[model samples]
Target: MKLPPWFRRRRVGVAATLVSVAALTAVMAPLQDDIGLLNEGLLLLLLTLVISGTWGREVGIFAAVTSNLALNFFFVEPLHTLTVQSPENVLALFVFLGVSIIGSSLLAAARASAEEARRREAETQVLLSLSRAMIGQTEPAEALASLCREVVAAFDAPGASVLTAAAGGWGVLAHAGSADAGRPADAQERTMAEQAASSGQITRIGHTGLGNSRRPRIVAPSGTQRIREADVGSAFVPLLFGDRTLGVLRLDGPIGATPFAQHPDSLLAAFAGEAALGVQRAELAQAASHADALRQADEMKTALMTSISHDLKTPLAGIKTAVSSLIDTSVEWSDEDREAFLATIDSQADRLNRVISDILDLNRIESGVIAPARRSVHVASLLDDVRERTALVTKPRVVTLDAGADIYAQADETLMAQALVNLIENAAKYSAAGAPIHLAASAAGASVEIVVSDEGPGIAARDLPHVFERFYRAQEGSRRVKGSGLGLAIVKGFVTLSGGSVRVESAPSGTRFVIQLPVAEQAKASA
Candidate 1:
C-alpha cells in the first residue's frame, strides 16, 4: 500500500539517522591501538554490524573499516603511523572487516525476503476474499462490478477496470476509481478491450511511451497524462476459461510509486478461474430465471386448456348418456353394440375430467390461493396413503415400499402424498403393466430423502433439467395425454416451500426421483 509521501519520508529519515549514529559511535569509541589490543576496534566493528546492517550493507562495511583506520592513526603509540603497533591488532581488524561485509549482506537479504513474503501473503488473502465474494453471482454486470471494486480495495490502487467482449468489439462492464470509471467506455479502449478479451494475454504498461501493439488510445485529463507513467504503470490480466477470454482485470498502481513490485501471476491465474466461474454461475442463474417465467406462463396456458376441457366435457357427458338411453329405446338395440358406444363416451369424458381437475389443482397450489400446510409427517405412512388412493392402477404394477419405516420430515402430508401419487401414476402410465415401482426413504445429515425408482425407459439427459418445468412434455407438443402437465410443477412448489428439494436422476436402467426434505427438530417448544 502507498502511504502519504510525507509518511514515507519520515520512515526513511528515521532509518538514516539510526545508521549515521551507529557509524559515528564505531569510529569514536576508545580502542587500545596496539598490535595485541586489536580486539577493541574489532569489537566496535561487530557492534556496528548487528545494529546497522539492514540500513545499508555498504554503510555498515564502510563504518567498520573506517573506524579501524581512525583508531590506528590517532590512538597508536607511534602517532600518525599506519602500523597497528601490534600484530594481534592486524588479525583482529581483518576478521572484523570480513564479518561486517558478509554478515550485513546476508542479514539484509534475509530481511528483504521476509518482508516480500509478508506482502505476498497479504495480497493472496485479498485476492481470495475477492474470489469468494464473486461466487454464485450470476449477473455479468454485477459480477464485473464486484470484481473491479474488490481489486481496487485489495491493491490500494488508483483505479481498476473490467473489460469484456461484446458485439463486434470489447466493452468496459465495470470500473472503480477516477475517469468516470463506471461510465461507458471510450470507443478506442472498448476496441482494445475486445482484442485483449480475444487474446487472453495480460497487457501491462506504464504511462510512458510504450504500449502493447494495440495501444491505449484514450487521453487523460489535461495537465495530467491520461495514463500517467507512474500511476498508470498498468497491469492487464485476462480472465480466461480455456480458449475463451471471459474478461480482463486492469489495475493502475498506487499514485507516485516508482515501478511497484511485480505482483505474482499464479495468484492472478487463480483469481481469473474464480471470475470465470462467477460469470458461468451468473449466466446459469439468468437462464434459469427466464426459464421460470416461461414455465409459469405455460402452466397458465395448461390451466386454461384444463378449464376448457371441464366446461366442454360436462355437457358432453350429459349428451353421451342421453344418446345411450335413446339408442336402447326401451330395449330395442343389441346389448353388445350399445355397450361398446356407451363405454367409449364414458372413457373419453373421464379423461377430460381428469385433465380439468389436474389443471385446477395445479393453479391453486402454484398461484398461492391454497398453500401447503407443512407439519411433521411419517414417510412410510404418506406412501401408504398414496398407495391406497392409487390402488386401482398400482394393483397390476406391484408397487413396493423399501425404506426406513420410522423416517419423518416437516412437510405437508397432503401435498407430499399427492407428489408420491403423481410419481407412481407417472410410472404406471408410462411403463408396461406389472413393472414395479419402488418407494424408499433414508436420513442424510440435515435432510430426509425419499426416492421413487421405477423400471421404465428413463428420461433422456437433454430432457432431465426440464422435467420439473410445466408442460415440458417429452411427447411432442401436439400429442395428447390425459394430463395437464402441471402435477410435477405443483410437486416442486410444495416441496421447496416446505424447506425441501427434489432432483431427478435417471439412466438406461431406470429413473430414480429423489426428494430431500429437512428433518423436524426435536425440541421442547419449537417443534
Candidate 2:
C-alpha cells in the first residue's frame, strides 16, 4: 500500500527534526560549562543548516523550529526553561532563530537544485546507452527486443513488453521480466495498448487523478467495449515514427511502482522515438538487400537471352544461305560447285548442332547433373580422337601431339575428348594462319599434364580471370573469332567433373592451357 503524499512528507520532516535535535542536545551537554551562550547558539544553528542542506524545504523548516526551541530551553540564561533573563538574551535568541531560518532556506534550495541535476544526468546516460545498443542492431525484431529489455532495466519496472501492430492484432515483439506480471492478462489491458497506439498518446491505467483525460470509448465488432482506467492497472506508451505509429510499449508493475508513469510524458516519448528510428533503419536495410539480389538476377536473365539470340542466328544464317544456293535450279550449278556448297551446308548444320549441345551441356554442368564415368585411357589415343574430330574445321593449321608410350590417365574418355576438341578449336581460331598448334602430354609426379600452347595473340591480362566463366569472351582480339563463348566454360566443367584441373598462362609470346588429370596408379608406377 502507498502512503498519502501529505502524510509521507510530514513523517520525513518529523524524523529529520528529531535526529537533528538529538545530535545538538548530546553535543551541548558535555561543553555547557565551558561554552558560553553565544557558542551554544552557534552550534545549534550549524546543526540546522546541515540538516536543511541534506533534506528539502519542508524538512528544513521543521528542523529550524526544533533547533530554536532547544536553544532557549538548554542554553539561555534561565537554564532548562523557555524564558530569557535579559534584553540581551532576548536579542541573542531572536538573532539565532532568524539566522537559522534564512540559512536553512538557502541551503534547502541549493540541495533541491543538486538533486535535480543528478536526476537529469542519470536520465541522459540511460538514453545514450539505449541509443548505442539499438544503433548496432541490423534486424528489426531483434532491435525492438533489445530496446524493451533496456527500458525495463532503466526504469526499474517489474516487467515490460513491446507490441507491434499487425494484420490480425497487436503482436508481441519482445518481453522482459515475468510473463504473468509484465504482459496484459485481460482484455481491458490490451484495449489500453490499442488506444495508445491508435491515438499516439501515453495511456495509463490505475493512475492518480493527475493528467487524466477520457478518450472516446472503443467498441470492437464483436461487441466488446473498452474499459476505463478504473478497471485496469498498467501504462501504455506509443512508439511513433514521423507520422506513423509503429507500436506500443507496455509497462506493468504494482500501483505507483512504475517509474515511467510518474515521469514526464516527454521523456518517455523521446525513448519511444529512438526505438522507432532503430526499427525503421533495420527495415530499410533488409529491403535494400532483397532489392539488390533481385537486380542481379534480372541482369543475368537479360544477358542469357542476348547471348542465345546471337549464337543461334549466326549458324542458322549460314545453313539457310547454303541450302538456298543448292536448291536453285535456275543457277545451273556444276558438280564441283554443288559439292562445295553441300559441304558448306553440312558444316554449318554441324556447327548448329554443336552450339545446341554446348548450351545443354553447360546447363547440365551448372545444375550438378553431369557426373563423369571415369576410366583408364591412353593419353595418345585421346589426343588422336580430338585431332580427328577437329580436323574438319581446323584445316590448314597443323596439330601436333607428343606423349610418352603407355602413359594413361584416369578420366571419362568422352568428356576428356570433348575438352581437348574445344581447346584445339580455340587455339586454331586465335593463332596465326597455318601456325602449328602443340598438344603435348607428360607424366608429372602422380598426374598426367596435357599442355595446349598456341602461337596466337595472347589473352589480355585483365580478361584471363573470367575466361572460364560462361558466355565470357576475350574482348581484345576476339572480334574476328566466331564462337558461342561456351567452349572454354564447357572444357572447365568437364575437366572439373573428371577430378582434374585446368588453368592458363598468357603473355605477348603465346598462350598455354595446362590440364592436369590424375594418372592411373599402375601407369604411373610403370613410368
Candidate 3:
C-alpha cells in the first residue's frame, strides 16, 4: 500500500535507527554486568547523533526517541523492561535523550541553509542566461521568441508563447517547443491573459491539487494580486514595464499536466517583466528610425521647390522682356536694331530650352534611367566640338585648349562633350571678361585626364563638398553670377554614367575641375 509522504520520507531513517538500537542493546546486554548503565547510554547516544545528522530533524527526533527507549529497556537497572529501576539511571537516560535532540536540530538547520543557497544559485544562473539571450536583439518579435525559448528551458515546460498587444487585440509574436505552442490563445485563455496584463499580475490556471495544497500562498505587491491554485489549463504571466504592461507570456503543456506549476509565481513574473523591457526598447528604436527617414524626405522636398522656383524665373524673365520690346509699336526700329533685338529673343529662348532639358535630364539620372552608350572617342576632337558650341558664351572670355591629337577615352561622345561644355560655361560665367580659361587633356596610365582650370576667384572651402549636389549654388559666387546651378550637377551625373569620375580642386590661385575616363582598348593598341 502507498504510504503518506511524511511516513515515506522517514521510512529509511526509521528502519536504520531501529536496527542500530536493536544491535547496540543486544551486544551491550551481555556486558551489562561489567559495563555501567551510563557507559551503555553514551554508546546509544552516539548512534542517535549520526542518524539525526544524515536524515534531518524529524527523522533525527525519531532516532533519538528510539535510542532512549532501547537504553531504558535493555541497559538500565530494570534490564529488558521499559522502566528505569534506579533514579540515577532515569536521570542518565533523560540526559542522553536531551543531548541527541539538541545535536539533531543543529545538523538539520545546517542542511536547510545549504539547500537554500543551492536553490538561489540555480535561480541566478537561469536569470543570467535569460538576460544574455535578450541582449542586442533589435527586433521586438525576435527578442520575444528568444525569451519564450529561455523560459521553456528554464522551467522544463512542454511549450511557451508570448502574446503582444496588437491593433485589434492580442497577437502571438513568438513561441517555442511544441508545434501547437504558437497557436492563438482561445477566448477563455485570452481572458485570463488580459486579466493578468491589465492588472499587472501573474495568473496561473491549472490543476493545483497535485502539489502542496496547504503550502504558504505567495502574496503580490500593492496593486497586484496573488494567484491561488485552481483547476485550469495554463499560466498567464504579464510582461510589465513599470505601470505599462507590454504583453503576456502564456505557458502550457499537455492536458491535466502543468509543467510550470512547480515554479514560484513571483520568479516567473519577474522574468516576464524583463522580457517586456526588451520589447519596449526594440519598438522605440524602430519608431526612431522611421521618424528619421521621414524627416530627410521632407527636407528634400522643401529644397527641390525652392531651387525650381529660382532657376525657372531667371530665363523666363529674359524671354518676357525681349518679347515685350519687339511687340512695342510706339517706337519703330531700324533693320540693325531689329536684328539685334531678334537675336536677343532667340538666345534667351534657347537658354530657357536648355534649363527645361537640364531639369528632365536630372530627373532621369536620379531615377537610375541614364545608361551611357560608350565608345572610343578622340579627346581633342571632343574638346573642339564643345569649344565651338560654347562660342557664344566664351567670346569675350579667352578659352584655350591643349590636348594631343591622338588622346582617346572610352565614353559616350555626346555626354562627354556636354560635360566639357558645362564646365567651360561655368568657368566663363565666373571668370573676368579678359581672363583665360585653360582646357588640357592627356593620357595618364590606363586613364585619360581632362582638366578645366579658370583664373577666377576660388570657391569657398565649405561650399566644395556640396558643389555637385543638384540645385546647389555657391553662397559667395551665386550672388555675383547668374546660373541655374545645374551645370556641375549635370557634369557629375553624365561622367559617372560613362564609367568615369569627376572632382574639383579650389585654391586662392584658381579653381580646377578634373575628369578621368578609362583609355579605350583600340586607342591603347594604336599607341
Best by TM-score: 2
TM-score of each: 0.43, 0.62, 0.60
Taken over the whole model, the C-alpha lDDT of each candidate is 0.65, 0.76, 0.77
lDDT of 2 by residue, 1-527 (tens): 34344443557767867976987787887788898778888888887887777666667777878888888888776888898889998998788878988898999888767656765776787778887777867677777777777777676766667776655567676777666543433566567677787777767666332223343223332355544445434567788888988777776544333333334455566678876775566557768889999998898778878888888888788878878888888898999988988888888888888889999999988999977998787888789888889897678888888988777888888889889989998998888888888989999789999999998889999999988988887775677887888999999999999889999999877799999998875554345
lDDT of 1 by residue, 324-369 (tens): 6756667676778667667767766676676667767766766777
**Candidate that beats the other on TM-score, 1 or 3, i.e. the better one:** 3
Query: Across residues 125-151, which tens digit of lDDT does each residue of candidate 3 receive?
Result: 877898888887767778778888887
Q: Clashing residue pairs in candidate 3, if any?
A: none
Q: State the TM-score for model 3.
A: 0.60
Q: What is the alpha-carbon RMSD of candidate 2 to the true structure? A: 9.9
Best candidate according to lDDT = 3
Model 1 segments more than 4 A misplaced:
1-175, 178-332, 475-482, 521-527
- Worst 10-residue lDDT window, candidate 3: 208-217
**What RMSD does model 1 have?**
16.0
Tell me which of candidates 1 and 3 scores higher on lDDT.
Answer: 3
TM-score rank, highest first? 2, 3, 1
Q: Can you give the lDDT of residue 162 in candidate 3?
A: 83
